[model samples]
Target chain A: MSRTTVVAALAAGVLLVAGCSSDEPAPAPSSSGGAATADAGQDHDYTVEGFASSVLGDGTLDDLEDVGSASGEIEGGQVEAQIVSVVADAAGTELVVVLRGDDTGSPSRWSESRGVFTDVRGVEVVDEAAGWRLQPYTILDVSGESDLGCACSEFPYRLGEDGTVVQALLPPLTEGTTSVTVALPGLEPVPGVAVTWR
Target chain B: MQTRPRRTPRWPVALLAAAALTLPTAPAHAAAAPEPGSTVDVAGVDVPVHGTFSLRAAGNASRDLVRGAVHGVRRVEGGTAVYLSLGLPASASRSLPLSSIFTRSRDYESSALAAVTLVDRPGMTAYVPLRGGDAAPYSSDVSEFRALKPGELVVLWAVFPELPAGTRTVDVLVGDARAAVTGVPVEDGALEPVADDLVPQAGEGWPKIAEGDALAGAEAPWSVRPLVQHRGSVDEVTDVAETAEEVDATLAADVLFDKSSATLTAASQDAIARLAADIAARGTGEVRVVGHTDSDGSDSSNQTLSEQRAAAVVAALQPASGTAVTFVAEGRGESEPVAPNTSPENMQLNRRVTVSYQVQEATR
Candidate 1:
């Protein structure tokens, strides 16, 4: 376990024992179902392995709702971007993570394959420090389409808690720039959840 | 002590009577309220799970005090709910699963208490930790208590905050535990309007009002004022409010009928009814009923037929009680047909009425 996980576990254990008497009867098993797998320090990449359900600590991630965006190209089709926002529900138990990004391309073409397609699936965080804050990372990773005998034709991917990431894979673009927005509804209950960029 | 007054002796009798009533009225035993700052341990986490719940006062605008223990918290995105549990044998900690229940009352504020219970058996007697307090109305309180049952797991409920009407964004939090933030677009009860005043007639395209293009084209004889666009059509321009030039209320219908047939078919009537109702409710723009026919018929015959048809429709629409009805009957025999008479389908297209809309003369 990383230092953060160890610290969180110790802190949680101490708080739990503080209020109870030493001789109090041991707590019975709870009827509520199962425990979540620990998600400490696990930054989600658009890769298939990064999309599993994991437990998040308190104050780690911020809840995001109703994410949407429009695509814009800058830096000669090398960089792309989208803007997003969400509402706040105090009783929520998880943070909603949304991703929307586009690849740079020609202005006249309406299709995305004719240009680079930078999306939330193409960018991934490589390394980070102990307290790296997370911004909305629209683009997750980027891959060159030239390897597949297709110029500018590339697929973009994103992560969803609903296990829809695999089924909802994006296809290679046709031309210009393509914008993809991942909207996750519902509540998030974690604390201090952050995203890192490589 | 010494007897000071003889008149005070009457007070002793009154005290005896009051004691008799007050003694019986008191509760058998007052239940003590739980102390503040309690903690619940579950899975590898400690939750400060106790707090006072209450609704605010009235006259300060809102009411509906909601307070109570609800079902457990579930990760909607991840599809998991957590229940806190502690074991006596220090090394044997386990995570419990739980669901959620939500409740609210009409009043803006009220108080409720919830207890967390851990059972030895799935459905047997369990350990319960109770917390009680007042809550605001319409607020949903979720927690980890459930109706007792053999197979039932953990349950929790929460008094969630208010949501806005249309697509809304909200962050769901537990004290400070952010379960998740989702951008949910609350569905407004309002019916979204489909494209309106669509003039689909051939020959005359929609008019060009400023930077926007209407159904004024060479193919469609009748012009349409596009209201709302769904999935984006050719003539529909989003955000046309700023640059589009407004046009005068001319003939606004998707169709023009043949002379003197007051018979509006079932298909044609549906479109006309929608247009008529839209105009009547929106503004003072009245429907102008014009009738035309193919050159196969005589002038006098066509003229009368056109007049009869226009009148029939005007009668059909009996505009909302006070709406003005404008029926103009002009017969142009075979003058304009949307499509060429080469195919039967093209001929049928010409044998119809056009519907369109313009700003009500009064509103502009």
Candidate 2:
């Protein structure tokens, strides 16, 4: 068989396995079912070769409120973002979100190009009276270190699905422990997620 | 402690005699209360260069201050010569070491500890004391390294060449401190006084004026005068003083060059000349000329056209001789338009050229 055909066949086989091993629960079906299919397909295992391993540090995980996962399809593949934790520090409180993407159609493309958090837009957290748009922290280097004389990285991250994971640092939040709604484009709002600080 | 001799091999006593004849004596004006703006610190002492007039004068002033309540300044052949006077406070007991006062770097041509430079100018030029001849019009004493005792002033001098014409005010930078000198009038090959009150008053501190506040309190009468009207259909020049890295000038391409052509029109020539003059009057460094185009043409064609236009501007800015300024050209084509190409006016805004120069303050 031709090289192009061989590559395509291999990509399909990998996607089939990834799609089956997804831990995400099957999304509820709707009359249109378009959004459901897109969300279901995006929940596949994105832990590919070049992805970041963990977004949370050893002890920082205890400070976060797990708000569950949200998914959407983008230009080259599917994107999944999970609002895992929130931590308050001297600078401000931040949302620690883990982001992953699956692109079985072209696994080699992911090998060449790593992920960037700027691709995700319109993600926000809303309280009953006010809403704060989440902006990606962008001052970190490749090793996740902030060179701005700070002890830790202040910027967000973009991770590939090759067994890699990244902790995306969202903008600062002023409200204390409260129920907030997390909204993503083309996905239902995950409401009543408690944002508690440690 | 040793008292160092002021004469050096590079300077001869015979040349000093000739200079004394031509050098203008210090003006007899009563020493006004030290203007807070003229003071700059050197080592641990306060140095103030006196006079409140603009340097944009027609004739060069023979004696000027170099801050620190001492050192003198004057117009020399190629550039300006500043006489550095190192002194100690009267309360001091023994002589203080020169090593503690000035930097001792291998980069300088002289063993002296301190160096002098213009504020915005780049490249580090060592301060060499007067080695005799017509160069040291004010003093024949060569600059040297020596310990200073209480109530004594040690004078050293250095010369800076090729300052642009019509330069009215400039900050004389030494070590980490800078003293602002105003009214050292420019001699444009002839002597004629041009009245200018836009001179900035130095505040009572080192590096007198703060960044982004060059014109903050310049509410003098000259600033409010109406701008001289130009004679063409040319668009007004827009100057935006962004950060130190970005250029402060924006020129509309439509006013400078014909459509689809890189050649400058008569009106454009006038604009470019004024720009070149301004660059010279200020400091010198690397100049970036970037060109942009409207989205009407193909991407590749537009890129090539933009590049050509930027090169044309670089060619026009080349100095006649002995200038440190360098020019570079770049083109962004239709990709980085400042405005949408929906209307004629919007497209006109996109078709323009920007000029910026680098500032080398750290080296000074």
Candidate 3:
């Protein structure tokens, strides 16, 4: 098959289809099923949203991957980040993913001139057919101030359907939680990256 | 793993090809370059030699390979000449190659001499080869040994190429330095060969063995006790066991006195003090002191001089008195010797006394 289809197929194969296919028609107008339907419908209303934050790339997450460029979204108090470049520490215990903003109104680049933040507790890993699945929590640590300290210890996170972290080692965050941040040794205007949660 | 019987080294296909054709025979010869280092073999390694080594047995050797070298080795067959190569630095002696013996003018003629001495057998030869599988016959003559200078290293290899061979040991002596190597005979000759049996690899075990210790966790009896327990005192056994309570304190010392003199030398003082301490520690034991002399003087004078030496020691011990003492002095002049009578040290052992303790019985 084509490379695009293969990559997509690999990604989909990891979803782990567990339920059997149904053949019978749905029942009409069941009074007892109404309450359950309402709850199920409410769970689907989850709109990709999260708080915006950045962290040091000191192994606060597992299963971190590199995206093409750093452009992400912040929705529903949750940050959805698309990280491009990744930097691993000398000891292989921490990883840093460069974050960027890709919304039509603004484009972002991997630079040190800007601020980046993320929640240290959001990193998780999930093992799926498509290698490992990484799920991060909401960007709960974004303080808006540009002086986010050194990028020596924060990292960007990759999200999965089920919040599971996949990186081998994660460093404790400033608040004694897991977090990571990626920095290009001497670059300014550090790009803006966001995080999303399940 | 199944152990297959040892056999001759599997010669390369090319070597076997050469072996098939009959070659001319000649007396064994060494190569142009002699072994240049100490020779040693690891234990249980099977080494073999054919080709040139084989030709030596046929009595048609072309050139002498081990020209001038000292050797110490044991060979499988009889009649091989064994020689020890000397005159080189210890290191070079061990490495002098057997091949160094061949003369250029002679075009490497095989010499019948063995490097080390061995009992003569009609057609037996020991062919030694390097780890790289080169063989040279042992040489037998002191003149053939290559002279060694300072700071040279030589490695000599002992060749043993036969099957059903027992473990053979050889001490390779290079001047004063020595090393050892063992050889295992591999095979008789290349005939019907058995393949080695394959065994399970390490880390993989049968489940039965993994179960381990059929009687593990079986009941066992064990006990522990404190260092001291307060039990009522039991009856004592006759206060103390009947044993020797006294020790000998009188010791005879002989000092090399100036001719016909009674004066004791400074060396005699320490020996006399040790005797005094022993006597002071003995509760009330009698001391019998004796002395002897070397066969250097007339019998009567030696005896008199010995008595005087014993008296000197007694005089020194009398000052340290903690026990009653009885001094019985005797002299034996050159009557008995402990070592060779020729050395001064042997004479010293002869001129001494042994003390014995005589504890008196309790007075009823």
Model 2 stretches with alpha carbons more than 4 Å out: A1-198, B1-235, B244-246, B320-322, B360-364
All models, DockQ values? 0.01, 0.01, 0.00
Better of 1 and 3 by lDDT: 3
Of 1 and 2, the candidate ranking higher by DockQ: 1
What tens digits encode model 1's per-residue C-alpha lDDT throughout B1-364? Answer: 1111111112321222233223332211111111122222222122222222211111010211112111122221111122221111111122221121122222222322122212111011111112222222111122323222221112222222112122132211221111111222222121111112221111111111111021111111011111111111111110111001122121212233323355655545544454456456543444455554444466677556656665665566555413543444344444666556666655554444332334443442
* Candidate 3 residue runs with Cα over 4 Å from true position: A1-198, B1-260, B358-364
Native-referenced Cα lDDT, model 3:
0.27
Winning candidate number (TM-score): 2
**What is residue A28's positional error in candidate 3, in angstroms?**
72
**Which candidate do you rate higher for DockQ, 1 or 3?**
1
iRMSD for each candidate structure, in the order shown: 28.3, 38.1, 41.8
lDDT scores in order = 0.24, 0.39, 0.27
Ranking by lDDT: 2, 3, 1
**What DockQ number belongs to candidate 2?**
0.01
Q: Considering summed lDDT, which 10 consecutive residues are worst modelled in model 1 chain B?
A: B236-245
